[model samples]
Target: MVDLRALFSSNDPVGSAEAFTNRQNQWGLVATAIEDHLRHIADPGFNVEDLETSRNNVVHFHGVGGVGKSTLLRKIEASLTAADQRPTQ
Candidate 1:
């Protein structure tokens, strides 16, 4: 059986990258949204008017407690951090 103590011991939701798993669909959704947002912002003709019928830059994740919601968010944050540190082409 898995131990809950180890998971709860750390203040960090995700203990490490290795501990995060099985959320490829969620990750893909978030990553795509972020990429689209960045691409839109980088466009010279992009304006707030363009979002009139769009998602308004919001992505929501909802589930019962202790279902790895925080963990998923932390993993996304880590991914974004790693991406930010990479050299731009």
Candidate 2:
């Protein structure tokens, strides 16, 4: 559900290239899912849109113990890639 368009977008270019790119991609996934939330719920009339985008939106999913953050990222990436292959409206 992540808006693949947002993945290539960046509100901040004020950091290391690698880190910035990763952050942008991550947020794109989160935003996409969020934006599509209403459609996902079978409420066709309700829609969500992202208005204020910020550099601070970036979140590092890091931890020492067990967590599926990385796995989730990978899964999202794969799903988005597949979705992109489909024709867009």
By TM-score, who's the top model here? Answer: 1
Q: Which residue pairs clash in candidate 2? A: 2-32, 3-32
Backbone clashes, each candidate:
0, 2
lDDT of 1 by residue, 1-89 (tens): 44657656655454344444688888888989999989978889777665465555788998544557777777666766777674342
TM-score of 2: 0.29
Stretches off by above 4 angstroms in model 1 are 1-21, 47-55, 82-89
The 10-residue segment with the lowest total lDDT in model 1: 11-20
Go through the candidates in order and give each one's C-alpha lDDT.
0.69, 0.48
